[model samples]
Target: MTWLITGGAGYIGAHVARAMTGAGERVVALDDLSTGVPERLPDEIPLITGSTMDADLVKQVFAEHGVTGVVHLAARKQVAESVAQPTRYYRENVGGLATLLEGACEAGIERFVFSSSAAVYGNPDVDLITEDTPCAPVNPYGETKLAGEWLVRAAGQAHGMATVCLRYFNVAGAAAPLLSDTGVFNIVPMVFDRLTRNEAPRIFGDDYPTPDGTCVRDYIHVADLAEAHLAAARRLTRGGAAGDLTVNIGRGEGVSVRELITVIGEVTGDGRAPVVEERRSGDAPRAVASAARAAEVLGWRARRGVREMVESAWQGWQLHHGK
Candidate 1:
């Protein structure tokens, strides 16, 4: 079956596209190239250079490529920027998704995999976040994702389609240096940037209610996350589940900021101390995934550890920086 992977040239999308194609699944990629790198995609995969907001273009791609399934990963994901411009986030993430869903339903696509986020459970009070955890997004970005999930599920139910929403935790590492995440939105790359400049990495809040007084998070390798998508897509094709499947893609392990900084120092051979600063607002003290539902539903679990993530990420950093 031919699958259309939106934002397939970006870091996570590129990995998903490669994994799907490697599994012998027919694939076509659609990316706007806003922050995506075309070079990251395999040479043989056909790429459509456009946005999902363009209903005409999306429909054209679906019809032209004979797309039977869709993996939607295209969205404005920056939390801070989403807060600053909520309307744009709604328009791009939510509105664009509605348009795409309309096109997908019209084109007779029955399977869908949406890219959700852990941000939907903003600052959860629970020890570990599960698929059943209450969703209370603190930022506009997360709100848009939750709203998109509703739209996807409603559309699927109405159209008799199978859908899966994968809520991602902290994504890191890379399948290859070229596929490494180029954005510095997460701690891994933020610390990598500071180390590259021989500067002390800034640790955002050290007074959190966690070990070593720093925030803790669940970090998952990008490759493992991509494989999770494959599992979800495969399940959709089987048609056994009664409703849309929602699952978390994580390792079910928590790593503190201080601990991660030390790991980075060890991995990069740069043991520069980090500079602690006041806590950023909306920062969760601890956010870890249960990952039980994912295994039960998709038979998928993360295989790579934090050390491997750091090692692979450091290699990508060196390659990208020419260090």
Candidate 2:
């Protein structure tokens, strides 16, 4: 079955596309190229450069590619940007999903896999988060993801489509240097940026209730995260589950900001200390995941550790920056 991968030129999307294609799956990449690098995709893969908001274009791609399944990863994902520009986030993320669903349903696509985020949980007070956690998103980005999940499920049920929503935590690392995450918004890249500049990395807060007084997060390698997408796609293809399957993709361990910085120093041999800054508003102290459901449902588990994340990401960073 040919699958339409929205945002397939992006970092995570590129990895997913590479894995899917390597597995002998028929893949078509649909990216707007706003932040996506076309070179990240293979030479043979056909990439349709456009926006998912354009319903006509989306439908046309579906028909032209003979797409029977879809993996929707196109959306504005920056938390800060979404916080500042809620309207744009809502329009692009939520509106884009609605338009794509319309196209998928119209094309009678049998399978759909949505790229969701752990941001939907906001600041869960639990030690280990599960799929059943109450979704009270604190920011516009999270709100859009949660809302998008609803849209995917509803559309799938209405149209009799198999669907899966993969909720990702802090994603880091790369399968290859060329495929490393290029954005500085994430903490891993942020730390790498500071080290490369010979400047001290700044921690957002140090007065939280955690043992280290810093935010604790679950980090999953981008390679592992991409593999999870492939697994979810296979499940959809097999039609093992009748309804929607929502699962968290993570390493199930909490790494404090302090600890993460220390690991980065070790990985890069830049033992410079980090500067503690004031806590950013809406920062969650801890948001570790319980990956049991993902393992049970998709038979997928993250294989890389934080150190691997740092080293692999460092290789890409050095390559990209000539460092």
Candidate 3:
């Protein structure tokens, strides 16, 4: 089946596009090159350059590509930035998606895979969050993502579409580029970018309720997260499930900030260490996912572990920084 990937030139989208093409599937990458690089896309995969907010452009994409399924990874994903500019987040994240959905429905696309986030759970009280957990997003970014999820649900209900919203938790690493040109504000690669030479990676909320008094997160490899999208597409294609599906795509383990820094030191061969600072408000102490639902539904599990996450990220950082 042919697939249309929004933001296909970005990190996770690029990885998914490559994965699709490597499996001998027909694919079209629709990206505006905002944070995305054209060089990231494979030549064989046709790249459609335009904004998702343009209804005519998105419709044109569907007409030219014969798209059967969509992997929608395009959105304003920065939590801090969203907090600063809520209007931009609403317009870009929610508005652009509305246009995309209208175009998708008109073009008769039935399957969709949304890039949701564990931030929707907004610091769940439970040790491990599940699909049934209430969405109480703390930041504007998370609110927009949750709104996007609801929009997907509405589309599914009105039409006969089957959708899977993969909620990611502290996504990092690279089968490709972990350090994709995420805006300067992101957590992982931004830290690595600053520290490629001797700069220290900054840690917010050093005294969290975790093993080492630093925040703990479930960091999944970008490739594995991309694979989860693929598996969901197949499951939906088989007419297996109905209604809006939300699943956490995490490794189901907590990697502390200090632990990650140690791994980074090993990866970069720079034992410079991370600079700890006072807590950032709205920061979750520990966010681990009960990814059991993903395993059951998508038959997907994160095969690459913590070490791979650190090393592959270093690989991308080294290449980006000419180290």
In model 2, which runs have C-alpha deviations exceeding 4 angstroms?
none
Which stretch of 10 consecutive residues in model 2 shows the poorest summed lDDT? 234-243
Whose TM-score is higher: candidate 2's or candidate 3's? 2
RMSD of 1: 0.8
Tell me the alpha-carbon RMSD of every candidate. 0.8, 0.9, 1.7
Q: Arrange candidates by TM-score, descending.
A: 1, 2, 3
lDDT digits (tens) for residues 103-177 of candidate 3? 899888899888888878898877888889888999999999999999998997798888889899877777866
Better of 1 and 3 by lDDT: 1
TM-score per candidate:
0.99, 0.98, 0.95
State the C-alpha lDDT per candidate: 0.93, 0.94, 0.84
Q: List the residue pairs that clash in candidate 3.
A: none
Query: Residue 8, candidate 1: how far off, in angstroms?
Result: 0.3
**Tens digit of lDDT per residue, candidate 2, span 1-323?**
99899999999999999999998899999999999999899898999999999999999999988999999999999988998999999999999999999999999999999999999998989999999999999999999999999999999899999999999999999999999888898998898888888899999999999999999999999999989999999988888554799999999999999999999999889989999999998988999999999999899999999999999999999988755
Ranking by lDDT: 2, 1, 3
